[model samples]
Target: MFTVLPAAGGYTMSENTKVIARIRRLMALGTRNSNPHEAARAVALAQRLMQRHGLTPDMLSLHDIQESVCQNLTSNAEKVPAWLSSLATVVCMATGCRCWFGWHIHTSCSGVKSVRRSLHFYGFSGRAEVALYIYTVLQRQLRADTDGQIAGYRKRRILKNTLRRRADQFREGWVSGVWQVLQSFAPSECENSMLQRWLAQRHTGDTLGNVNVRAAGKCRGDRAARVAGWLAGRDTEVHQGLTGAQAQQQITAGGCTHE
Candidate 1:
């Protein structure tokens, strides 16, 4: 029941309707599937549809859609690293979803204090779902990459303090590099402008915080390792390339059931 008013050269209302229906179905399939492959396929399909029609995630209006707002509580603030939080913000913004952090404070009987942190998402149901899915996948990939780097440093017999410092430096570089690459995936200016107008009319202030990561450090000959990590991060498969129309239609009809 969503209505997307046609902008010049944009998809027709009929096309928008079809796209929105397909997105909802895909989202539902993604949610039900425990395997992340299905979710990734759904995201790929949505990206293809948006690219084919020159549409952004926010272009399809959800005024009449009955999809409810959803929220996910992440790990405690103390456990979540700054780089991870920044990456989450970047993913939410790139996916056209709004996110904020919430802290839950508790005190033990022994007078020790602790805080649990959560990242809250608010937006159209389907987009919010997609944003969380993307964030989870990216976060895992980043951690794996960081672990690999740390293992390599350990193998090199570097001093303990130097190893820790270099690991931190590498992480900072990798996060910053990945963030820069992700920004390239943001919606086009025209689409963003349209989205701003729509949100303004609805009075939804979807603002994202800034992501700040330290510059990658280079210690003597270790610059190559940092550069390699940055390149690998940039090459992370966040979004798949466009598929043929037949493939896209098959995906849409099957609702991401295909492998």
Candidate 2:
């Protein structure tokens, strides 16, 4: 039978257990530090210790595998953009989580009622929280870019239809680029197995669904906009433990939210 161990198992801390704990702490610090140099050093030290101790991914991610939770991130828009869904996919892959669209009824302050959509993330609590935080940051960044694009289009007296099309293309390209950078960090087989088991137990009757995102770059000047967005996404500094530019800054579990 498969056994789950607590973060601190009841037994005395073995030498290897201590090493694992130390490595975990170092990694946490590395991801949270704003100082790039210190973050890099801490990550490197953690790697060295892992190597010294012959630590495997399964061992390092033990705590995560043992615990799972669901986090719902309500979308500001009732109908989420296709790019937003793609962005969530990238975040889920990077953070070892699974995501699905969900909705709840919300009543406005003025007593108006509407359906509010949210993205539900299921994974280890830390991974779910990290996924939510990263999604929020990237969502804002994408919106900001589109807003700037819209402003420029308005200055040039461009049609609203063209502006919307280009903005959508840009967001699509951005998600594609970010996916290239972080897809390698997807969850291991062991983690996936644990997650599937947890889902079966806790999220029974859940079904898989596909989000059909269109290809980017169809209209005139669309290629340029997509290229610009791809470059921006490639340059995006992912502040979490995932492999990317400036691999620092993960919110601690039960930390404050930007929402």
Candidate 3:
């Protein structure tokens, strides 16, 4: 999609700037695949690359980086997500992030590590919900598409090859369906009530998975405190069957407050 940006006076960004912006947008589109630490690492890597190329890398904050990234920077070369790369081009050139856009190239892989479910991985649940809804619609439509093809292949005596192809197609379809179904299915739609109760604290609403994680954490911590308090009682007197270590463990796990 074409966007109008503030008109610049004969200003053209260098290739490196274009490449860097593309990289940022590409990373942003893969929102579920990263967290803040990963974003930080990415930011560090990008900064270093700029430095190596003898350019000054702007020290960008997390919010700045996120905004810059979501803006969809791109170049004619399109080294990144070719689809959204154009968006990046307009954002970078038109409404600049005030980053010290330059031609330096710094390189290092020190900051990239996988942190599961960090904040950088945004909208996984929401996307998953939408994905599930889409998948259900697709599923009801798939067999019609493939069954028609299989019947044709059978009638043509496209026998042996067609049979294998049919099998492959069915397997592929099944796998695709399962994935889409899973993606669209929220954790709240989970079978276990206890788990749902726990998750409801973190991801709430009309969706099955709404829950307050903070409340859950407090509950877990409080349980430990209560257990610790009970264990302290046992410390002075060992019960008939339980040993001191076991008593201590039981108490600690129960969530007793030390003080």
Candidate 4:
């Protein structure tokens, strides 16, 4: 005969699992290693590649970042922060690249006043930064090469297609969609709702629609401005990692509502 368990235990740690083990061996020390030297060496390759791709222009800073993280994180006798190992494993399987973003997110994703925890939960926000960098650089390259049309062809519009209330658009729901990508790169992390969704219900602009509506307020052009404020207010580290262009892209991709 078998026995029934209470809450649950031993779920597979796949891209799907958000929190594999709260009691992870190294919930804190992590893989970076406390000495800092060894952990830096392990992730050096990843940092270099990101820098080369313009993900990091201040090349030296990348080195320092590695060292700092490892120094604080690694431990000779203690288990490495399971978060790092899990993140590293996912990077190898999916991106086939090192955990450049993973490392970046580990240290940078902080300051979530209302959200709780940090963005380090997933890798895609870093990837989002990378993608935006790629998108911007490509845009610049295109402008120099062929006509604007050529650049347009290579460009991806992150703009929304009206309110994302429909099922088809819903599948590409900004929060869920981006969340899915980020989770693939990082260890199990809690998902974030698109700030706009919350702001729409919370922020109000010029007295056009509801005049003084709070929480999902009506708006004119100021809606975009308000959303911008929300993102900036949410997390500066994440804000720093992303380019202004990406900000516009994410807004356009899903920042409007007809209702």
TM-score of every model? 0.46, 0.59, 0.19, 0.17
Residue pairs clashing in model 2 are 31-249, 239-248
Pick by lDDT: 1 or 3, better one: 1
lDDT of 3 by residue, 57-166 (tens): 22211112211112111111212222122212222222211111111122338865431210101111122222222223333433344354456556765456445434
Candidate 3 lDDT at 126 equals 28
Give the alpha carbon lDDT tens digit for every residue of 111-186 in model 1. 9987555554434325555666667667677778878888877777677666755665655556666765554234
Report the number of clashing residue pairs per model: 2, 2, 36, 17
Off by over 4 Å in 3: 1-125, 166-259
All candidates' lDDT scores?
Answer: 0.52, 0.61, 0.29, 0.26
Q: Which candidate ranks first by lDDT, i.e. highest?
A: 2
Selected candidate, larger lDDT, 1 vs 4: 1
Query: What lDDT, from 0 to 1, does candidate 2 have?
Result: 0.61
What is candidate 3's CA lDDT for residue 254?
12
lDDT of 2 at 144: 77
- Candidate 4: segments with Cα more than 4 A from true spot: 1-124, 147-192, 198-259
Q: Write the per-residue lDDT of candidate 4 for residues 163-249, one digit (tens) a residue.
A: 211211211122222222222321121112322222222223311121111122232323443333233222222234333344334
| Winner by TM-score between candidate 3 and candidate 2 | 2
